[model samples]
Target: MDAEHIRAIAQQTGCTHIHPGYGFLSESPQLASLFPEGGAIVFIGPSTGTLRVASDKMQSRALAVHNGVPVAPGAHVSSAEDVHKFVEGLGSAPFPIIIKALDGGGGRGIRLVYAEDHIDHAFRRCVGESASRRVFAEKAFVGPGWRHVEVQIVGDGLGNVSHLWERECSVQRRFQKVVEMAPSTLPRDTVGHVIEAALKMARHLQYKSLGTFEFLIDDHAKHWIFLEINPRIQVEHTVTEELLNIDLVKAQLQLSLPKASLEVVLPAWTMSPQPSPPPGYAIQLRLVAEDPHKDFRLSTGTIGPADVFWPSGRGVRVDTWLSTGPYYRGGLQWAVGVDFDSLLAKIVVHAGTFQEASARALRALRETRIAGDVKTNVEILSGVIAHQDWSSGRIYTQWLEEKVDQLVQLGNTQLTRQSRGSLSDTAAPRRLSGGTESATATALLQPGASFQLSLSPSLPQAASGQQTQKHTLVISSIGRNAFPNELSGTITTSLSAMPLSFSLSQLSSIMASAHTEFANPADPSHVASPIAGKIVELHPALETVAGDANKGSYVRKGEPLVVISVMKMESVVNAPASGRVVRVGRGIEVGNIVAEGALLCVLDVTDMDKGLARL
Candidate 1:
């Protein structure tokens, strides 16, 4: 949204074109208008008018309604009273009402209000999250099998538009898409209606460049509601491109030409009488750097090039910003820090059938190996693809959340099975593949670091009342790297003469535990921040809990205490147990950055039942 800075840079560098590739200023009408028509520079995106209308959720909903498209029951709301009235108007339609920002996307600035008391908090959070300070209330379409579908469309400034097809994005976490597949599993006729609806809106507005028309389908697949239009390319655009064998970014550039048209930009589609479904199936998985075991908390650390491995083949494609060059300070090492998106890369696979695609995706995930202190969603992605429900297409937006525990267990079991026989019987350290010896040495034993290695007999030992032998290894020095895979190091170890053996996985586990143990707070009374992020809002009841004389506020277990915003997602920190807040951490307030493991508050558990408090 910093149009002036971008303009100044473009002018200084003598650049003639600016392509806002999704996010940030991609949907900013003000940014698009900065480079006027016939100017020295051109904005490779929709015109200012189209951006203004499409970026506003309320205006887009009104446009959908005017064009005879169905939209959920909703109204512009500025206060809790307006939200209550909107809910009253719905009557018995639905219990949970959704509060959303008027101009938010990518699942941010949204809250689900399930009761009247939560309306005010959700409303205030939405207002604070939105840049416009505007919000809306709508009846939520709670479903056991609801699906999120979107149509890919491209148009020129002259009102000519082409529908590229639709994508099924039902697999999501916290309203953010996790997996997307091209050519929805819905019936042909149902998809046809959605495509036509998208084209109608795009043609009416003469929408130029690429955009997405999002919709929510009911469980029965018999009804759908217009959600909103994303007036820019999305993260899932790779799914559509892989399915159709076309370059969407190239197409966007071609359409921005002075005299571009559908016939010139896409001759293959113009020659056909109607838009035909592309052959084959393509699935894209969003590989994020997060820990599913910790409620998808963002994982931050330096991931060396030798610490990770990527899958590649004929039909598999991995798109990421990771590289191994001196241009970056870390040189191919992923320095995943806080205050940024958790997305690491997108792994896309294409096959002749859905089953084949799923199988290939599983194989690719199994081949992926990420080590060191960083964590990823690769295991969770594998679990989802291998689930029976996923294979049978019985999924919805909330399905992952409901089955996360089961899926995590399944993924762990699969991993265990894969590594069952990986250890060798020989009493020697095995060399790990895809990693330099120096890098491996650096990972296992840094200079002056001490580690313990337990040694067990390679063969059955005689029954004895003695403890197993242990070795204390200390790293003395790590000489300069003279070769890529050569390392000179001295490991002073106290070892006994015995047939002993250990595996590489054991060493890796020790290294990981040593690095991450500090992030887990030891004191139970201290409420620690789960991840590094900014505290956006503090609980109202916490005001009186800051003093010693007040006795603080009595909060029950699972009650919210603070809301933290990180990586464009909001996470609520709830009370761990029934207790009174006796102290708030110094400098912990709204808009304050809180580090992981930093104390947020202190809880007084005098009134909490012992049994209840343990929970």
Candidate 2:
């Protein structure tokens, strides 16, 4: 919530407490100072000193090291020159070190350096990123394998704290965790050690409110090392809640003040481990606002006109800020108009075991769709779900980076097929009527004339490589008053009529054995707006086509018809080909869904004899 808006509401409702829920101003020292002087609002969190201690990575590391917590061997370099000095001292250090930002939130200001060549570049990048994002840097940890485990503990404002087990956050993309599960795949004894260490760290710092102690578990050695302590609620809090059955939020709100200890019993301390394992599995995939095809490029803006199918079962929960309808579009795209936002819709699942829960989550994601100019990363997510490495729990942090190429190809292929408007397997096209009219052997005819024309072969062959097929039309005077000397009503023709182009839609219908009409391009009729996007603007049209070509204008195929812009990118409307307009609507403009082949304007190319003879 906006601070000012919350303050306004606080004044109206006479509310006394303002609890900042993690991130932003939640951990700010100045907020605590400012709120009290205002007289009404009381900020609920740790004091200014606790925040200051927890905010700096170097200080936290030193504190943890002093308390007998195992930590990675990395030096904090204040400048590029300092990095060189640190590098010199480390004569035989291993490659592929992680450089982290001191003040970075999330994984934004981190870099993984592989070799000596990358050292300088990595240092420079981290320095710039940290400075700009207000983060600091740390050297990477080299181990056989690495697993991220986090322990959650809440203080009673006095001193007592309770543990809420640990969450395994090993699965990642670009160093950012995408999937997290409670009760890591680590051994029971290992978990117990980590939990005990976390409590010690918490007690040492006298931590208060909801906090998580992070650790990097060594792959081969089975050793856990303290990384840092997040003195606020984490994004993966739901996972802890699922396994522990504890509402950290409610607990935080209730025990925020400097109150005495409560006698309430917490939920079952930790997840129970079977002698073998659980009956099923639970896996979660983070649905970020990104295009997985484009190297997982952050797709900023309203992510969807989507439907939220809440995954249900004994262990399914969707913690999202969206609901049914277009209102729930994700991501707050700043450049475009308002109505943009992204969320960490924590979709959780519980089953007899891990495999079942993973299956359920996969199925739920497959059923999801976003109806708008925005596209989703569904394909990549699905790929990850089906990946053997992921299924077997053999995934690493570099998994996504390795599979980026294949995922990009697959996603792009899907987009190409979707854009072509090929709704089905059949690629054949239908034909339209009134191709051409023959010249009369006797009298001259004006260009503006509507004639009922017949075709020798009503349907034309499929359009092949820009080579157009011709239709022979026979046209004659309808009444004796119209043509006095014409033989009967239909005049015998020696020459064939000019050819009229049939659009993809018309060809489709004819191929499907449907009745046909003449090709009329001028029908400013709307068709199904094939692709989905926001309508930006419609160009001013000066000409309108009527059914009769001689009396009205004709629109050529591939001519600009309408435009729909998706995600701020513009797309144009076009005429299929040269055909007479039958009925163009005046109100047809931007934001209108022109159903496939809906008539635009009416046009009659009846002077086929004159035009065809020329052809």
Candidate 3:
């Protein structure tokens, strides 16, 4: 992550030229400037002086002030007192404040303080969260329809700059861009101002090569404020390239050449031979293997076969870092772990109109199926492009957070139905002959139906990602007659190639057995563990705050019975209903390891049903 480590690698690999790309050392002035001392390697980016000012949010804010660029009114706050001082300086800039990492990226180190009381905690949290150990406070840009617009700039080493228009990066989650579109639709004068501001900063810093100037467009106030300067090629660079028929990375390389000039750098893109600026619109969506409903946590575990389809022809392009599908690990099963960024690919579409491009991109995503139970954000992507706000170009940075629930629901239904249909495709049995229509699933599972299923041996490969152990295989073959209604295949997650026979009459039972998860909550007879965790707090069924254990006292539903800590998250085991605890779990203490479905304590909830229903 530091310059020395990267330098060591460059030396070890004998690379004469190094591209820091976007994260880590991309904005490190120390890395960029110090690398020139090596004399053998060239860093394809801005000068150390430019990056020094651009990478530091505080310094960048100062630069904006000098250039008369509008910036969100705020200050560099190192302590709680400084936060108050900056807020007081705003006068009428509202109460809530936002604390940000001075050098953080990807929205990792940011906290919004909603009230005066939370400033201390939020400031402390932000300080610890930021890798640079520096935090800045800014006037929270509140109100509706706040958008993100970035101007793409290419500067020669001589303070000369050219603009490639702007990009709308309004659709975001966690303050990070999720979808980016070029040729942003904004007021013409306002767009021109943004471009002018970007070029001014580039000239001010003598910025060279590729860089992006980010801004926060407050639609309510009809104003745009300076945010930061990304002194490297960005993830959404493809959008601008698609609209202009240019290669930005190649341009970055050309800038580092001897006696490099704009015309000499990329004649086709920036010279006389350059064609007219391409027309139409282009939209790009970053597809990641994450579930939106679950707070976009890592979906690292079992990875099944990936049936990725990259659309050909026209303006459709999918750029991915992973070439092949996930493979077996530890000589057992297929899986993908959280070793790298969850970004699986970027889907870019260029068409005659925005609607057409949006439609085309959606089609490509739905078809680019990553098979198995691998959860992805495709359905979320689908919802975004099709949403009314997005279609009207009225999106904001928090649009994804606002539409998370609706998007997740749509995605769940789509994915669940897809998985359910996969079962139908995989569980076909006896074929009917001399008939026009095919047999229904019910007919196949009826008596006298014969079918065959397939299975694969569990084989492991050398672990490459973060996880080493074998993850449970999500998909397993099940022929029509191979499994009966009584027996299910869900029990064979780790097993491989085991053949079994069952009756067709057991279809209903088989489906239930294969799909049933955890323990049934409908039956309160068994108070099993809902998740694998440790019993960090075992309380009496009914206890007085004065330290009296009332064993026979009635426990109300939703009352905390046990507290379990799993993976740093705490989950409370609640009383299912108003019932007396028959017995406290034996040997269960403040710290006892409990597996999922492990018995916690028995509850006499005979009357809980009626009481809970009434409640």
Highest-lDDT candidate: 1
Work out the TM-score per prediction: 0.82, 0.60, 0.68
Query: Clashes in model 1: which pairs?
Result: none
- The collision pairs in model 3 are 331-460, 332-460, 453-479, 485-506, 485-507
Stronger candidate by lDDT (1 vs 3): 1
Off by over 4 Å in 1: 219-221, 325-332, 414-522, 539-560, 577-580, 586-590, 607-615
The per-model lDDT (C-alpha) reads 0.76, 0.54, 0.66
Q: Is candidate 1 or candidate 3 better by TM-score?
A: 1
Off by over 4 Å in 2: 1-15, 33-40, 117-121, 131-137, 142-144, 257-262, 268-283, 301-310, 324-344, 405-615
Q: Give the TM-score of candidate 3.
A: 0.68
lDDT of 1 by residue, 240-322 (tens): 88888888899999988898887777747534657567888999999998899888888766566656567789789998766
